[model samples]
Target chain A: MNKNSLKILEKNRDPFRSVKLTVGITISIIFIFPIIWMMFVSVKPDGFMTTNPVEWFTPPYTFSNYVDLIMNSLILRWLWNSLIVAVITTILTLVITSLAAFAISQMKFRFKNTIFIFFLLGLMIPGEATIIPLYEIVKSLNMIDSYAGLILPMIASPLGVIILKSFFDGVPREVIESAIMDGCSYLKLFYKIVLPLAKPAMAAIGIFTFIGSWNNFLWPYLSILSETLYTLPVGLPVFNSTYSQAYVQPMTANAIASIPVIVAFLIFEKQIVKGISFTGIKG
Target chain B: MNSKKKAWMQDLRALPFLLPFFIAYLIFTIFPIFKGLEMSLYEWNLVRKLEFVGLENYTEMFQDEFFWDSLWNTTLFVILTTPTMVALALVLALLANLNTKLQTFFRGSFFLPSILSVAVISFLAIFMLQPYNGLVNTVLQLVGINAEPFWMADKTLAWVTIVVVTLWWTVGFNMVLFLAGLQDIPESLYEASEIDGATRWEQFRYITLPQLIPIGRVILLLQILASYKVFAQILLITGGGPGGATRPLIQYIYEVGFTKNNLGYAATMSYALFFILLVLSIIQLRSQRSEGK
Candidate 1:
């Protein structure tokens, strides 16, 4: 090898590069192992978790856990309930958050910054801390075991406003003013003029909201008393207690419940990345 | 005259747009926070009559040993989780920044567990850590070690398990943040440092670390806040087992408010958590302000 190529190769061969790859691959395996292991156990025999300690990779791979879980439990019903709650919450959240974002970012109003700052306080107050009061509020409104109880409390989200507002802020003033000069109504300016441009941001907000609502356990567990209305996160625990003996079977249900969001995340990973980075930047 | 009328119309136009979310936020989130503060001062149990016992609940909370224990446990959790997750994420981000063919693959792989629900992650943890014929114990036994320590049932291990499972479930997010931060750092700085014969560690310590501080603050704040909210996973995994060693303030408050039907006292404990978070919030906002934004 020539001297210059030798030097280039040697520099590239610095052990840190290899070390980084090794560590990266190793940690990635560790991170992903839980999900993969869950999938494996989900397909394993019902009683095999306790009985068959050895032979993890060999002989029997069964579909009994998935079958039994589907037939015997209310997993699909739980999924349906979660879907309904998440979809409704996502739609409502989109409307409210986008409108609020538009007003805060685009419009001229008195107390605009002050009102926006007030909403920012909600950023510090997590939903968990308010569970007790929220429970009482919902129960007093007779919303227990109902869809409204699940969906309403979630509609007043703050992050979407922040993210979408930043995006809306980027829309040039000239565009809005030109639209106004053409005698466009404010509502038309928002729906027709602004929203299409903010569609990517909307998608990011929507997926985040949906995944959030889907994964939420605390609120649904507190609000929904009936089995029929239980979301997946809440429902899985009850199933765990009910079918305490069949450990592997419930894991099948667990895997099933986890699939939608994981898939959603995988499919929308680019937008989700943009969303996450946007949040970090705007923070 | 016409300008004044148009400005008036503009103000009204903005209100309708803002009001839907504002009204809901007022009722559910904002009002409840204030109500929670008020509830802390009273002795209004769910079933019992509402009687004014001003400051008694707060006083009782101070003297309450269980309250002390839970608060300690929560602080322990916050201390353990936030730094470990953030540091691990920084490491993963550094490694992923190596620009290999496997970069995207490893990034996505590391992040996969994070998108799964906490309940799902907790259940998976149980399968691996079940003390008897569990995957981890099985593997350990195969390697000639007979140590199958009670993972969740034991007090200390339950704490460790919660933190570890939490790391598995959440480090992806912080890793993504660090990756973003790392990418934002200009490549020219590294090139300049390399030309100056700076070592890898020096470059990272000086350039990368300094650049990451702002995002690091955000991650630290978020991780602290998020770790404090940890409940369902622990509730299912440990169930505050081995004598309430793993119970956080949230779960503790949840039990008091709902299971015990002592909503007032629960709200009192909730107020304590709120004040603690209020301090955290102030620190966070202060950090944001110091960043000149």
Candidate 2:
């Protein structure tokens, strides 16, 4: 390699590297400090955290906050509700959106463009705007406080279709045509060929939908009147308000709501980042 | 069969696949839009349609002080959060993109808060910003700054708290996007700049900054739209209190519809917000198209 290329290759060994590292680590810690505090405070034994000029580290930590939350509160129930709602929302969104996207991308039909645009119009219509009437519709259908009420409206977002349609479009038409020549029905082709080929896109959509559903607070907060039907995001705030007198138990509940998602995020960090960037750019 | 019949059959074949999503979209999305507009034109309640008020809701919304305050608050939040978020995300992305062994750790720490639910972050904000014993005030006092600022009670401080918590919770996602943009910058450009003896700052100012403009615009507009929708965090953290200084339009709409059972007025306000968003979206689409050329 030439001298310039050699210097560029050695850029990682530049003299300012240590300074960069220090800045990076410091900033990262600053970003993560609140969450760290929440976790530490959750475990601190009562009266230990009450000291002024709050201590970052206090020994004699206990799991009593967690124990109290699990034993006394409906936290587990809320967690269960959140899980079911997010899972169903993700699965249904994928199925419904992908099916529609496949037809729009791969099938020739009258009003195909019109239909695609109809769904795309949803991209402009924010979910917050639709809630008033959506609540009315849900109430009329007697679906308030039910899983369907939570899951169905969420599946209406056009994002999955918008993302997946492009992916479906990229599938080589020759393969599809040859499969059709081999007597494959559209359903069979969709499940046996196109769906498998679209795994990466599907995964991206699945992650987005799952995270969105799990973190959804507004709709559930408005619709769910019964405490039992509350999701984690909905239930935690109510729990906080009801128990505002104490910090430990509430922090424990925050930690409880957080830990699982954090663990999942760590596990799927790459895919999650990729998914978000994709949707953020595309949609 | 005639060609017309065959064409119709081709359309019919796609029907089964399209039906499920369309049905849900219609019932939940398209239907709600028209239904919301319809509701806005009447004196509706949570239970039933009380009367056909005929634009009275819209007229009242125009004159309502709370409506205007909430709308202005939402706009103010968009102004507060969007630029700061875009600029900060760019910095964090640059930092996270540093060629270091701890790259993954940096990325994880920065993005970690984003995975947290709004409630978790809002609760953490409240926990940390307590006037007397909160982490922020305590830390400030430790550093010899003795003012125990009430973060949620004061108008300016409440906005600060909401904006900062929002940045902490969301900037990671934008950082990830910026990182993606940064990575896509061709290595050859940097190498060529190095050969020309350009300093790092020069390289960044000329090549990196110019290259990042498109993604920066995307993040800027996305942040604006997202900030305009800010509700749950403010609602939870301050309850839009200290005299409703931080209440966004969505919170007002929620209160009107659910709290007061005035669905008509609520729906009217929703359409107002929707119209604002629609105009912003059109601007985004226009800019994107022009850039594409």
Specify the CAPRI tier of model 1. medium
Q: Write the per-residue lDDT of candidate 1 for residues A184-275, one digit (tens) a residue.
A: 98899999989999998898778677778878888888888889888888888777776665667767888899877778777877777766
The DockQ for candidate 1, computed on C-alphas, is 0.60
In angstroms, the error of model 1 at B154 is 2.3
Residue pairs of candidate 2 with colliding backbone atoms: none
Off by over 4 Å in 1: A1-13, A50-54, A281-283, B1-7, B47-49
Report backbone clashes per prediction.
0, 0
* DockQ, all candidates in order: 0.60, 0.72
Q: Write the per-residue lDDT of candidate 1 for residues B1-293, one digit (tens) a residue.
A: 69889888889988999999999999898988887877776776765439788888888888988888888878888999988999899888887777678987787887787777767788778767877677887777878888878887678888888899988887878888888899899867876776788876788799999999998998898788777777888888888776988788888888888887788999988878887877787787788779874
Chain A TM-score for each candidate, in the given order?
0.87, 0.93
Query: In candidate 1 chain A, what residue range of length 10 has the lowest lDDT sum?
Result: A49-58
